[model samples]
Every structure is written in structure tokens, then in C-alpha cells.
Target: MSEYQKPLPIIEFQAQKEFWDGCKKHQLLIQKCRDCGEINRRSVRMLCPNCLSGNLEFIQASGKGKIYSFSTIMAYPPQGFQDDVPYVVAIIDLEEGTRFRSNIVDCDIDALKCDMDVEVVWEDITDEYALPKFRPLKQGS
Candidate 1:
């Protein structure tokens, strides 16, 4: 393994495991409230934000979104991303009205723009783990 791979995020609990398991399967999963049909992307609260009910389940997301905002990383890389110093980190607003932060890959950093259409691309970090990334959608795709 590479040095950067040694310090990966720990999936310790059931909630975390469930989320990461979907990643391993190359799927973008989001928590949905059964009570209110609300989708929770960033928040991990057990209760539904709309109905205050404790019935939530992870479901496959559409894997489509637009870039809300972004930053280019040119230095001082994080432990697992040392090899990828020059990269784009972005907040993507999904079509489902939820947003999540992830790396923007497979495109020129200089070409990135806010509101650019993007789609999910999985980075298989290991046999049991994957990272959900985004890439600019092609014009005709």
C-alpha cells in the first residue's frame, strides 16, 4: 500500500459502514427519511429533519449534480491525498436538492466553474472502500 493509503477514514459504526458499503459498490447513497421523503446528504442525524421521525434509510442517489463551490488544493495535502496535491474539492448540489462535498476529478482545474454540471465517479481505494468523486459532464452526455 502507498503511504497515503495507510491513514484511511475509519468506518467504525453501523451508520458509517452502511454509507461506505454503498461506496464500495460504486453507488452514491444518501439518507432518506421514510416519514417525510426528505433526503439528508450532509447531516447524519438519526431523526428526519422534516418530520422528526427516526425512520431513515440509505438509498441510491441519482449521482448527478452541479458544482456549488470549489477550491483548488495546491499544497499541504491531507494524509490520503498527498499524491494528489493539485486537485479540486467541491460542494455539489444534487438534483435531489441535497449537497455533498467531494473531489472534482478528470478535468482541468483551471476549467472548473460554479454551476458546472457534474456526475459521480467512483475511486476504488481498496477492496472494501471507495471514494465518490465528481467529473464534469460531457456536453452531449
Candidate 2:
């Protein structure tokens, strides 16, 4: 692939390292609290939000979710994303009961709607990183 000009994730800690590593392998990972059984969508936190416990483990997510909300960017695109204007950014509510923000792709922007099913699609932007984006779920896999 060509050199990616977009900003990439800054992996500063171990949790972030594990998260990026999982993404590089096309695996969607979330943090599960060992103390309270709470699953956190963000892996950057050292303590569980539900329970103050540092005992957390990484678990692979199914990468299936529904669009909780979305917005179509029609103007003022961010730096390095000028070519990707009119894209859809969405908040996905994963089946595992956590939500995260990702871009929706491979579908018509006009056809987008809330509560629509979606699944993970990786963008292997570089040799060291593979970002997970979402797309409308196909009728049959």
C-alpha cells in the first residue's frame, strides 16, 4: 500500500500495545475486568470503569455490532482525510455490550441508518498497523 498520511494510533502502554497487536492480526480485542466482569471497549484504561480493578484481560470480540448513531461528513475534512470526504463516522454498539467509534464503509451514505447491522473490516494501512473499520453487514456471509 502507499504511505499512509493519516494519523495512526499512539500505543504508549501495555494495554495499548496488546490492542494494536490484536488489530494487526485482524482480531478485535476488548478488556474484560476480572473483578466485576465488566467488558470495556477501550483498552487504554488501567482500571476498570465499573470496578476499580487493575485485573483485566484482553478478549477477542465478535466484531459484530449495530450502528448506534452516525454522521456523514460532507465538509471540512480533517488533515490527511481530504480524499475520504463524505464518509460516515458511527458509534457502534457491539454485541458484547460495549460501544466504540469507527468509520462505516462499503455502503451508500444515503442508505445509512441507525440500528443497522455492521461488521468489522480491517484497513491494513501499513506494515505495522491495521485499523478496524465497519461496514454494513451483508445479507449472507
| Cα misplacement distance, residue 17 of candidate 1 (Å) | 1.5
Worst 10 residues of 1 by lDDT: 1-10
- Candidates in order, TM-scores: namely 0.88, 0.94
Q: For residues 15-124, write the lDDT of model 2, one tens digit per residue.
A: 88888999999999999999999887564687898888999899899999999999999899988888999899999999999898999999989999999999999999
- CA-lDDT, candidates in order: 0.85, 0.91
Residue pairs with colliding backbones in model 2 are none
Give lDDT: candidate 1, residue 80: 68
Winning candidate number (TM-score): 2
Candidate 1, 1-141: lDDT as tens digits: 243354566765677788888888888888898888888755566677778888989888899999999999999986767877898989999988899998899998898999999999988777778889999999999
Query: What residue pairs are clashing in model 1?
Result: none
